[model samples]
Target: MDRFESLAERRIREAMERGDFDDLPLAGQPLDFSDVDDPQWWIKRWMEREQIDTAALAPMVIQLRREADGFPDALRRFDREDDVRAYLEDYNHRVKQDRVESRFSRESRIIAPVVDVEVTVVRWRELG
Candidate 1:
């Protein structure tokens, strides 16, 4: 095993000296990933490339959290304060319902927190 390992290392060193790896793609560039936190990053990249709706595969709590994260941007579609309030109220209602169901279900352990409608309303007005 040691003999084979040394032979492989010597061949790699000889190749490097011969500039055999100089023209390889992204030879001097940094990798796209800056961290190793997400293990499913390759799957995500493939999904994006295929134009798949990756969100559909996520849990409901994750979906709600994603929606809540983009709530400010989604508010741009609403032209009226009443519409914003109603939308937020509906979202909060779903959060509450999911929280109750999650507690009773064995599969789901994470329950998304309800959005604060009045605070979100103020944010919506600010976005206008």
Candidate 2:
């Protein structure tokens, strides 16, 4: 196996020698990376390119944050004020539970704040 090349590697090397990769689009041109200031830029781009949903790949805390952001509009789903309060309370409970459970894991380092149920209830009233 000393001088052997895998089939994929051999095909790639042969293609390179034949200049098959030459004259390709964007060859030798500078990449447009002006928007790479985000630390997770590559991951975000890959997800976009592959048509993957961010929520599918995100952890529970991140999903919760997303849910909280759209929750005000979602409050309309509950016809009664008590239902909204219960939903907000359940959301807060999940957030707190995640915080406690992730205390020592990598996700623990994420600073996800728990949703305030009272403030949300007030918001729900305003929406009403």
Candidate 3:
């Protein structure tokens, strides 16, 4: 450690002195942010920039929320009301489990609430 300069900072300073950053694209433009303290935050931003599917990286509740948004479509896979009801049961069971899991963590709970499968099934009928 030399004074307050970090290794990465020192390298960047040297590169600037050598004019290595002169010809870089968008070099003169201000960056929204270059440093993020949270690794998860950085990874999420990189995933977004790369157009990556980061559903696995998201919290269980967030994943559930996305699934819930498409729940009507999922029920469409079943031709019978009984099958639809069974699938809804399973989905709601998992949502309850996730809510319990959220209580065990001290970090921010991003878990969304469960959707009303009954109402969604009604909407599906209107669309049909």
Candidate 4:
């Protein structure tokens, strides 16, 4: 190992021999995780600890994407097929026409199931 790491390890060993590490919190116990593994696990753990609402701080584009993804589910409030079709067409038109630094493309929107209002809306509701 590197010199710094070797030195730190030696110090820790010395402390352990001196019983300086005994009686510490959660000693000899595996960490208890109430959540799944994630790339931003620290953020999730911190949010759970502090009761933070991460969604409130999410970017508008991210929020918009979530809303768009669940558009069919939200359209469950509508009881008419025409309303569902109209809403889907409007959303598809918006996504197709959006020019956000070229990050979004017509092809991307074109390939997404969320944009296919008729089949998605009907199928999603029927599955419910």
Candidate 5:
């Protein structure tokens, strides 16, 4: 897993938290992407459901490409389930840390639009 996969996992967790799939249409359907594992299908589905902005999600495809490219070669060599599981645990932790650091940096910006708006309002009222 890499940035996009981590982000996608976060998005999925958020969606789950919001009960977005309580009565999911595909709940009982046996859907498998192994035969047709195109990432476009995921994007198309999200677009059709209006879950995310298509334009914003366009960059995620690039992230997915990076993720696919950076997938651990050790996992490919693993023949046992336990080995795969251990590799996934470490990979997941690394991805989680990357996602957290990325989010922290984004949040740390002092000039964020929302923060600027609040500050402007407070200063305006103070000057009045």
Candidate 6:
């Protein structure tokens, strides 16, 4: 797992151990990301709702965004179309597999908290 995934997993384990979402006021509330698709969007919402220091999570958010955008650039750098297609296909397959595992893994429990913190930190880092 990458940094974001590792961090997310850790946060989820911590939350489950505590039985409450740490540092997030909405821990007990139902979460719906249907309208909020972007990591940054969720960060802002969580910050506003939780009234916490958003700066702390800025680096993680930027890192996650960077990773999210990485595959396309990686594929584009390939010299051959076939190579690019192969890379993309492999990437997609890996992503799908990870998604499936994440859905069933305990680490997924922390996805929301990790995302929330990441966005807040990103905003905070930008301001600083």
| RMSD each, Å | 8.2, 6.9, 7.4, 9.4, 25.3, 22.1
Ranking by lDDT: 1, 2, 3, 4, 6, 5
Among the numbered candidates, top TM-score falls to: 1
The per-residue C-alpha lDDT of model 3 at residue 117 equals 71
* Order of the predicted models by TM-score, top scorer first: 1, 2, 3, 4, 6, 5
Residue 20 miss distance in model 1 (angstroms): 46
> Candidate 6 at residue 49, lDDT?
82
The digit string of per-residue lDDT tens for model 2 on 5-124 reads 888988898899999999998899999797699998998888888999766678887888788878688898888888888888888888888888888686447645677778887887
lDDT of 4 at 4: 62
**Per-residue alpha-carbon lDDT of candidate 4 for residues 87-120, written as tens digits (9 for 90 to 100):** 7787766554443433654334323223666577
lDDT of 3 by residue, 1-128 (tens): 37999889999999989998888888788876655666677777888899998677778888888888786876676777777777777888889998898898986877766667788778667666
Q: What lDDT tens digits, residue by residue, belong to model 1 across residues 28-79? A: 9878874357898888788887999967888888999889989778999999
Q: Pick the candidate with the highest lDDT.
A: 1
Model 1 bad stretches (over 4 Å): 1-51
lDDT for every model?
Answer: 0.85, 0.82, 0.79, 0.68, 0.51, 0.53
For model 2, where is the 10-residue window of minimal lDDT? 106-115
TM-score of every candidate: 0.57, 0.54, 0.52, 0.39, 0.27, 0.31
Q: On residues 68-110, what C-alpha lDDT tens digit does candidate 5 reach at each position?
A: 3444442455555555556555544555555555565644322
Better of 5 and 6 by lDDT: 6
User: Can you write out model 6's per-residue Cα lDDT over 93-112, one digit (the tens) per residue?
Assistant: 55555555668665523221
Candidate 1: minimum summed lDDT over ten consecutive residues — where?
A: 1-10
**Candidate number with the higher TM-score (1 or 4):** 1
